[model samples]
Target: MVDVQGTVTDGFEPVRDAFAENFARRGERGAAVALYRDGRKVVDLWAGTKDADAPGDGPSAPWERGTAQIVRSATKGVAAAVPLLLHQRGLVDLDAPVGTYWPEFKAAGKERVLVRHLLAHRAGLPALDTPLTPAEAVDGVSGPRALAAQAPAWEPGTDHGYHAQTYSWLIGELVERITGRSAGRWIAEEIAGPLGLDLWIGLPESERHRPGRISDVEPPADPAAPGLRMRPRKAVTDAYDDPASLTRRAFAAISPAADENAPAWRAAELPASAGIATAEGLARFYASLIGDVDGHRRLFAPATLTLARTEESAGPDRVLIVNTRFGLGYMLHGPASPLLGPGSFGHPGRGGSLAFADPESGISFGYVTNGMQKNVTADPRAQALVRGVARALAG
Candidate 1:
């Protein structure tokens, strides 16, 4: 067995072993996983190489494991929570028309759209009508400019679609408009700092060395196959091109998906994407939600956590083109969910990154990896680790 170099709290040994099994079975090059239950961490383990192409590197060395890794779309759950937190503080309202916050959003018949609609992935604007460069997408001004100028794919609030790259800009702008601080800064100061976790929306320059170099995603043999959950047409033009392509143009500079270890990418405050953290930090972030964390709660009220866990949308997604159930700011557990049972709520990244809070059983599980996989949502290997945590909780 490839020994991982992290600590596991007592009573969650099964979860530790289960993660080990998945790491070995899948030939995981680099990965980190952490779980918390009842306001306490239960499972924390990581192993393997930073890049799949360099697997001969021993997993036994503590220095071999990566740190401050990117978690991809999992950043959305954390980002969306910012507005919800503001709402609870009486600074913003979720039911109010979104245009009330950003006047330009009134263009394109989006005047009636509510803030909840954005949280639900029903605001449309899934695809840009015109091709946008990654620079345009992340340039503080360009993202909102394009969103305000573009037309919605469908009527807002009438249909659900995975916003893909647009979600971060949508919510991040709102947080900035409301709080006068970038979503990344707010999250760093309000959420991560208060919780004493190392998670980052935009990474810090000093933390760059901690992350493993990102490896290229394996390309599918056939793009037309039904096995594809996010089709080519469904993705932005910059998503992927040519076989064995390592980088997506979508993250050219300031986008959340920026280079695995670039200084600018780490410094920019993109709330919807580009979060960097350790599994321990992510688990600590969620652990605060499960209960009082040393008597300090980042969220304004406890009931807000309930709102986050409750279902908001479930049906065919306009962008993903599949049924997706979502809570206020997180992905709820469902038949198609990667997490085990309905009590789990978290987000999964396009590659192999995952984070969840199983409040019913008081469990939080997080996994971060450098290896990029073809599957977007249905990676059984991630779910298997979640299931193992569930069994440990039950036992």
Candidate 2:
């Protein structure tokens, strides 16, 4: 195992093995994992090189360091949290019609859609029917405005489908309409700011140098490669492998740009997919749900937290093609869930980054890696760390 350094108040040493195995698998690239319990920082560790160009930093390079890479869809969970928090304060209503807040959304038979449907990934605007470039996707006003005009793929709440890339803009517009501030600013001023979390819905240019430079993983040369064909049509072909296609458009920070680490990309703030955060900040955010950090509580009420962990949709997600279940704003432990445990509720980004909370056990975990893996969830490397954390927590 690559050298690791961190404290485990509960004395779970296996957590070290989790990091070791993944680093070994990645040839010693840089990554970080953090855990919080009862609102206190319990596990904060880092290792390897942050960038491939400047390797050989050794184990002492600083586990507590590194910038947020695009956590992909993990941003959805963070993005979902904004509306939920607002709902709690009567600033927004979960059961009320989404168009009630964002009138423009009513244009496409979305008048009956509720806020919960959007959070649950059932709003049905998965891929924008209108093709947009990376620049158009994140050019501030254009992305959300275009989404507001798009039509739903399925009936609002009839079936669940992962919104894929469109979720943030769809929900972001509602957030802006309701709070009068873009989701990014609101998250920064309300959630990240108060909690002292380094997470960002939109990244700022000043911190660009801090982020670990993410190199997109090259897809399998042969479609027959193991794991390459898992869901080749949807996950591979439709999402990442095409040149100048939707997947490329999806990655470009310009046309509905969801580029995980760009400055203009970070500034747009599509909570569903573009969240940037370090493992430390992510863990602390989750820890706040079960326990408060320095007297700060930035999530649902403890009871509401309990409510969120309860499964909402647990079957074939029309979009993801897996039996994914969702909690209020998090992913519930289900057959398709990576961590595969009852108490956990969180989401994994498209390329392997993840963050979640296990409220029943008062455990919060975060994993961030620069190396992008093709698998969306149940990633062996990420699961190893989670399993280690679980073993540590239980011990």
Candidate 3:
């Protein structure tokens, strides 16, 4: 049995069991799960080794409470909050054309793309025609510049698709253009700083040692293999198998993908993919979105929260090739990836990290892992934990 540590409140012990089962049965390398109810943390648990495959050790370092991991696209939820907070404060108009703030966005028949369109992934600029090198992606200016000059793959506001990597630059540039502050800086000063969370969009050199090194898990040898954890839907499989498909292009927009475990990638701000945080920190951040946490101010007012959670787009995502649902900037609960409940809103990382807030139950959850599975949506381990949470709430 994995030596799991930490505590869960009286009613939340089941969540700890589910977390332990992940290491015992689901091949979890290193991971942590945290949950908050109302304003208080109810469950905080972590287990396994930081690097299961590291050399010269009987086992890798113990997974400590302070250890964090890079939560790929799960970073989108935190990044989204920046613009949404600005909107709540009356600094941004969601319905306004993006050109109102970033004039360069007016080119390439994108003049009609509204701020909401960008948030909803309906702006039709999911991928860049010109691919960006890892260095260019890290530089910040090059990726957004390429996006500004390229035409949308589809008509603006006509259809929705997962922006994948482009969502970072699109939203990041918008935040900078409107507030004259980088999204990372704004998030640090306005959100993490106030809540006292360890989350970081642009990690500092001083804290580089805290994150666990990431390693990819191999997929099942046969695509048709039964009971495969990372099985893709038929539509998803068909789209991904085609090299020229929008789904493939959108995910590969950042060519020569940056080494996620590298110091440079962790220090640079890639709001969609490179957020580094402890599961507790991510849980606290989401908890604050729905209600005050430990006397810290709530991030979103009720009306703004409603707007952010409302379903803005739902249908076949042109890029993901799955029926994905998106709110203003969050991935909502759906058949594709049911997080906590119907009222839950959050984003999942490309591999295994998942986080969300369920206002109906007054619960917020965060899970991060260093052992990444090939699954794109809900990893089986996370799904098990959510099921445990549901069972706990039901009781």
Best by lDDT: 3
Give the per-residue lDDT digits (tens) of candidate 2, residues 1-395: 56675655558567777787788774446677888877878778877655433445553233346445567778887787778778778788788888888887788788888888888877866666566776777666776777678777678888876666777677788888888888888888988888888888877766665434332222212111123333444654443455444334333323433334446665667677667788888888888766778887546886667657777677766645556888777888765566637888998876567888877677888887766665655656777888887777667
Which residues of candidate 3, in runs, are more than 4 Å off?
Answer: 56-58, 209-232
Once model 1 is optimally superposed onto the true structure by TM-score, how far is the C-alpha of residue 93 displaced, in angstroms? 0.7
lDDT (tens digit, per residue) of candidate 1 on 253-318 = 233333544566556666666787777777778777667666775353667887787888887655
TM-score, per-candidate, Cα-based: 0.86, 0.85, 0.94
In candidate 2, position 70 carries an lDDT of 61
Residues 1-395, model 3: lDDT tens digits? 88999998998878988999998899888899999999899999988777645668465677888778888889999999998999999999999999999999899898999999999999998888878888999797997898889899999888899998898899999999999999988999999988888899998776775344332222211122122223365766777677688877888787766677678888888888889888999999999999999988789999889977899999788886667789999999986677887889999887788999999999999999887776677778889999999989987
Error of 2 at 157 (Å): 0.4
Report the poorest 10 consecutive residues by lDDT, candidate 3: 218-227
- Scanning candidate 1 in windows of ten residues, the lowest lDDT window is 218-227
lDDT of 2: 0.69
> Cα RMSDs of all predictions?
4.8, 4.2, 2.8
Give Cα distance to truth, residue 383, candidate 3, Å: 0.5
How does each model score on lDDT?
0.69, 0.69, 0.85
Output the worst ten-in-a-row residue range by lDDT, candidate 2: 216-225
